[model samples]
Target chain A: MSSTHIVSIYDEELKYLSRRISEMGGTAEQMVADSVRALVSADAALAQKVISEDVILDNAERQINEKAIVTIAKRQPMAADLREIMGTIRIAAELERVGDLGKNTAKRVIAVQSSGMPRKLARGLEHLAELALMQLKEVLDVFATRSVDKAKAIRERDDEIDAIYTSLFRELLTYMMEDPRNITPCTHLLFCAKNIERIGDHATNIAETIYYMATGSQPEGERPKDDTSTSVVTADVSEASE
Target chain B: MSSTHIVSIYDEELKYLSRRISEMGGTAEQMVADSVRALVSADAALAQKVISEDVILDNAERQINEKAIVTIAKRQPMAADLREIMGTIRIAAELERVGDLGKNTAKRVIAVQSSGMPRKLARGLEHLAELALMQLKEVLDVFATRSVDKAKAIRERDDEIDAIYTSLFRELLTYMMEDPRNITPCTHLLFCAKNIERIGDHATNIAETIYYMATGSQPEGERPKDDTSTSVVTADVSEASE
Candidate 1:
């Protein structure tokens, strides 16, 4: 084959790999959304689907890695092309963790379903899930378009999720205190909220990654302060009450 | 200068950059530890130190990025070296976040110092702080040694911390229920526990990154399921009594 032909073949392979990783990100986002919904709706089948679909996400991660290595070995890509490939690998790994978090959410839902908590709690959880899913979606959109503006907006939403988490936590704590019987279900709901919040955090992580990839600068945020007051005082009353 | 000499200079620059990032990691780790101690002891000066030292961490991140760009543009590193550079950039970013979280914890300390809570509560929080420090130390050790086994072990400790958090949470809740006035202080403690827990989580994330750098495999350990039946029932009973 001509040298040109060989370069073209390598180019095709790289493009194919990029598309695959992007598709994987899309699927992982969907799984997280479904995992939350299944937990909220007690949809056992959807939960099962999320659990099983994790294999696909896992496979995609493996494929992205293999393809990158093969391309490096054969094509010996340099400079910008190499950065793109490495970025793809890093993003794939992050997305894969996001998928695992989703699967964990699904597993928790299954466990909660078995414990038989009231359905009302699930409705509140659904709100948290929606918020998380929306954030994830926005980050994915930024990745697709490489839009720094969109990434910045998504970063701001992280605080929103944090605020929602506090309220959700208070609500669940109230439920558990009202009825010991509510503990199992409330705990399940709490985990669901946590999963969603974590998903939001991961979304922020991805957005920051995107920001770096595009602008080569860290996302601007006020340096986080090292105060224990908010956390300590919050726990103190809860401890006293308990 | 000869091309060969230029190549050597590039190599040296990359090495220097790596060493600086490593030093930054060490400094950030120390800052986090000090911040936690400050919160536990209410040491205003140490808290101020943590906040000030964060400037150094920020500068290290900026230097790493600048060096990576210079290396990429001037030397045009090949695939593996390129991956290493990118990985360094990403790891530095994660470490920067760890530093910010530490600062956030320290800030909370200042915010709650005047809340008039018992000093004993700091003991529980101190435990969390120790756990986070240990995790951070382990993760950095794994990074330095590239020990997959060490990374795996650190991953397990995440679960242990989670268990502590659960018990501590219950204890705090009980305290709040016992005296309504304890609510404010208890809430602060809860946030401290959470920040420490999150720091531990970030440490685990770094461990996962180390694993990826070493073996290209995602770390093990599924997310734990939430089991809150006992706590829920106890909470309910406590509420009824109130």
Candidate 2:
């Protein structure tokens, strides 16, 4: 083949990979939103849908990885082109994880379906999910636009999700303590919330990948963190109850 | 440059990537073991050490990635050699996440530190951790030996970790419901167990990667999964109590 023909084929291959990433991102985003909605509304059907749809993201990741390896072998891309391909691989992996977290959340719906979540607790979780979804959406856009500035902004915003998760963690523990009946359902909700919190972290991971793809270096400094529930000790039951 | 000199350099590059992966594997294994020991014994100092050591794995992943990208750009390897390079990248990422799960488990040590976990609960968690660590070690060995049969075996054994984790999940929830005082520490232990289970999952992931690197095709059939904790509903507190 002529050099021009080879170049066009390579370009088409790259575009195909990008389109796949975009499709994976959309599916991941919807799964996150739908999982949280299922939790809040106790919609088993939606949760089941999210669970089955996860294979789409899983397959997308595997296909992108196969295509990426093929492109690298055939094109022997160097420098910027190589970085873009590597970035897609990493981004696709992250989105696949995001899908896993969503499926995990949906899987818990069955556990809480019978007991039903309290509105107050559901509201707290909903608020946290919204922030996480916002972060996910913004970072996916950054991936598409290759905007370092917005990516940086999304990285900083992760602290918001962490903070919300910490608070919700405390609330769930307190509720579980207040009534033994709440233990099983609350445990499931806590995991679901943790799943959403991790979704936010994946978005941050994608942002970092975008930065590396564009600038050829990792983001400066450590990513911010505020999820302190790990060290939290509710020693005073009375205080927690109040 | 002579053709032999170029070949040797290319060989050296590939060797360096393998050594890095081995180093990463060793570190991740140690982290998983140390974190579980810290949790079982409530050793804050050991937990702190595990937390600090995570950066080493993170840096190793980044360095391996950089070298692999350069090797591909410089050597332009094809077929099996290219698959080997991509395999290293995927393996490094999995090890990095295993390190993260270990670090997250270590972070929870403080929450259960003061209260001191119940001996029975600790034993249950220890049992689960042992299974997960065994899985991790086996998979890392498979990565080194490139044994497709061993990889397939490890993939099947994931169900063992999942089964143990599901039992542990029920035990922790039961402990929490039996006594309100156990709520705070039990919650932390629950998450710790979940983290270990995830470590096992990463090991299975590594096994799959090793299989792909060896055969250029994904393993047949869906992976065996028995972690029914997601859908578990302990509605009858009385039943859980017994």
Residues A1-242 of candidate 1 have per-residue lDDT tens digits of: 99999989988986887688679878988898889878767788998899899889878887887787667656766565655665677678778878877887787665566555556666667777788888887787788888989888887767766777767776666655554455445555665676677787777777877777776667887622221114433343345235
Where is the poorest 10-residue window by lDDT in model 2 chain B? B223-232
TM-score for chain A, candidates 1 onward in order: 0.83, 0.97
Leading candidate by DockQ: 2
Task: Compose the digit string of candidate 2's lDDT tens values, residues A155-187.
Answer: 988877888899999999899888999999999
**What total of clashing residue pairs does each candidate reach?**
64, 0
**Listed models, DockQ each:** 0.20, 0.83
* lDDT of each residue in B31-70, candidate 2, tens digit only: 9899989988889999999999999998999999999999
- For model 1, residues B120-198, the per-residue Cα lDDT tens digits are 6667777777777888887887777778888878877777777777677666666655655544555556656766777
Native contacts recovered by model 1: 0.20
Query: Worst 10-residue stretch by lDDT in candidate 1 chain A?
Result: A223-232
Instruction: Label model 1 with its docking quality class.
Output: incorrect
